[model samples]
Target: MFNKIVLENGLRIVTENIPYVKSVSIGIWIEIGSRFENQSNNGISHFIEHMLFKGTENRTAKQIAESIDSVGGQLNAFTSKEFTCFYAKVLDEHLPLAVDVLADMIFNSKFNEEDIIKEKNVVFEEINMYEDSPEDLVHDLICQTMFDGHPLAYPILGSSSILEKINKKNVLDYYKQYYTPNNTVISIAGNFDTDKTIELIYKYFSNWIPVKKEKDEQCPPMFYRRIMGKTKNTEQLHLCLGMKGVPQGTNEMYHLMVLNNIFGGSMSSRLFQKIREERGLAYSIYSYPSSYKDTGMFTIYVGLNPNYVSTVLQLITEEIDKIKNGGMTSDEIYKSKEQLKGNYILGLESTSSRMSSMGKSELLHGKIYRPKEILEMIDSVQREDVENIAKEVLDFNRLNISFVGDINNNQIESNFKKIIG
Candidate 1:
């Protein structure tokens, strides 16, 4: 069971006690990310995330690290399309430290000028590192192409041009706009007293004055969401294709996940078997769904020899069509459900993953749908549910394709339209 508490000031705290675990993981989830920015402030959300760890009103950067380190705890954070998280794992004895430091970073960052100038260079180097990695490059190109004119197209690691000009003022302004208890969730799971944890969290978090922005001013929809294609310089041909899918929390999302597993998400999935092992096309191939607050994406990716790229793409399209038109066998449906259940149980074993699950659920849905409830929901899915989702999202006409790698005689780009069709 999961328990929820709302403070007088409107901060939602969700707690779960896993007695079998020796450690507790706590996550502070803020419902703001790249999708909240516009072209001028493209990567400000991510930049703000980096700046928070520099220091807060009560603790210096080194002190913050040492506090967690002294407890043998781990701390890290990430910025995503629809949310940002600062998370930590520590012995149950140190839950108060985890909550205090994570809350301080969220509500009390100083946004010091010296830190600002230094961190911009750090961010710039991070962008350069991303540029050097082919995997990151391909996904970046896909988002840019798919959401062409929207803020979602902005790279999480701001473009070098944007990062060079980012300043303390920009970081502070973004921070003030989005980081607040009203816009945040605190989730903790593992071996901790739920009542004591809530008391400590409320002690630190109750006075968070909500950051308010004028409702009259509206930013445009953050994602244009279309198909994007590109050619890049690399050894193997890289292919990415997808279309918009359901928003988070939709019942269809459960079906989509199960379908994706049977189609491309699992090691025994069609794409992995056909493209990787049976045909020797490439080393990696899979499909996944990315969820945002109000919208999401269904994507397929493969890396293959240039000579085999066309066949691989054709096979991918054919398999999708097969799923939509012919649907799955009874055994496929049963196995996919089993895989889904296994994954859910296995994922909950980690403190980080469990806390993240509760944090995001509370951020989006106002409560943590208990893990047992979620498993029951997954078990309730049927063949028709999976087929309906496949037909709903597999429309090639409404999709985007991103191709990376330098093919000496590249016909993949030239033949993409015909091949996908």
Candidate 2:
């Protein structure tokens, strides 16, 4: 069972005690993300994530890495448009130490000027690296186009022009505005004493004051989403399509997950069985759903020869029409439910996954739902529910598509015609 504790200072701690496991995964989830920024401060959240490792007031970046390495533990962090997390997986013997290190990086980083300059270039190079990978590029396009002009449209790895202008003061200012006790959740999983663990967190974080900041400036609703990005060549064509979907905490959210699983999400899904196994159109094809606090999207991605790009899009639309008109089978419904259960159960093996689960659920829903509860929720979804979601969501007229590859602009226009036709 997992236990939760809300601190006096407003930091929430979530923990699970698995006695059989000898390791613990701890994560600090800050609610703020790239969406909290304007164009001037874009990418600062990610840049600050990098800076956290460069050193704390008491530890150098190398010492931090070496300390974790010396103990055979792993320390890492990531930033997304919706949240940023710093996590550590350490042996149970070092749980207290891990908590100290993580809390320090989050609450007391010095943001050194020298390290800031070097990490800036590193982020720029990271952006270059993404330009070389079509899969990442096209998905970025999907997100940017799907939520055009909203903060969601901006890439997590902001452009070099903005990263170049990013500075230590700006990063620290962003951190101050958002990384507060009220805005953070601490998730810890695996063998540990609940009381002692909470004590460790309270001991470290108690002195930190809660911060209140101005609300993020709102943007208008997005429509007719499209990403037209230009870059150097790649072999295969990468294409992504998305339609606006439901937000979290709704009945429609459950149905959308089931709908995506049947259409193109699974290995047995219609898109996979038809496009890859049957037609030999691509090596990989799948769909997934992503939900933020207020909004969500259902997206499909495929890679194929630049020549057959049009055919792939047509097949995808055909499958969408099939699901929208006819609905899913008992067999697809059962298989997808089983797949969902299997993935959730398998995730329990890792402390990191559990930590993330605990944090995000609490952050988004103000509650923690166990794995068993989630599987049951998935299992309870019916074929009728899946079909209803498809009818409401899969509108060819409202679809958004993004392409990133070495192809003629005419092909892009042809894609639009085929979808609309």
Best model per TM-score: 2
Off by over 4 Å in 2: 217-220, 225-227
lDDT of 2 by residue, 20-123 (tens): 99999999999877887778978888888888999888888888888788899999999988889999999999998898889778866888899899999899
Assess candidate 2 and give its TM-score to the true structure: 0.96
TM-scores of all predicted structures: 0.93, 0.96
- Stretches of candidate 1 exceeding 4 Å from the true structure: 214-231, 407-410
RMSD of 2: 1.6
Cα error, residue 140 of model 2, in Å, equals: 0.5
lDDT of 1 at 111: 87
Decoy 1 TM-score against native: 0.93
Error of 2 at 359 (Å): 0.6
- Inter-residue clash pairs, candidate 2: none
Q: What is residue 183's positional error in candidate 1, in angstroms?
A: 0.8
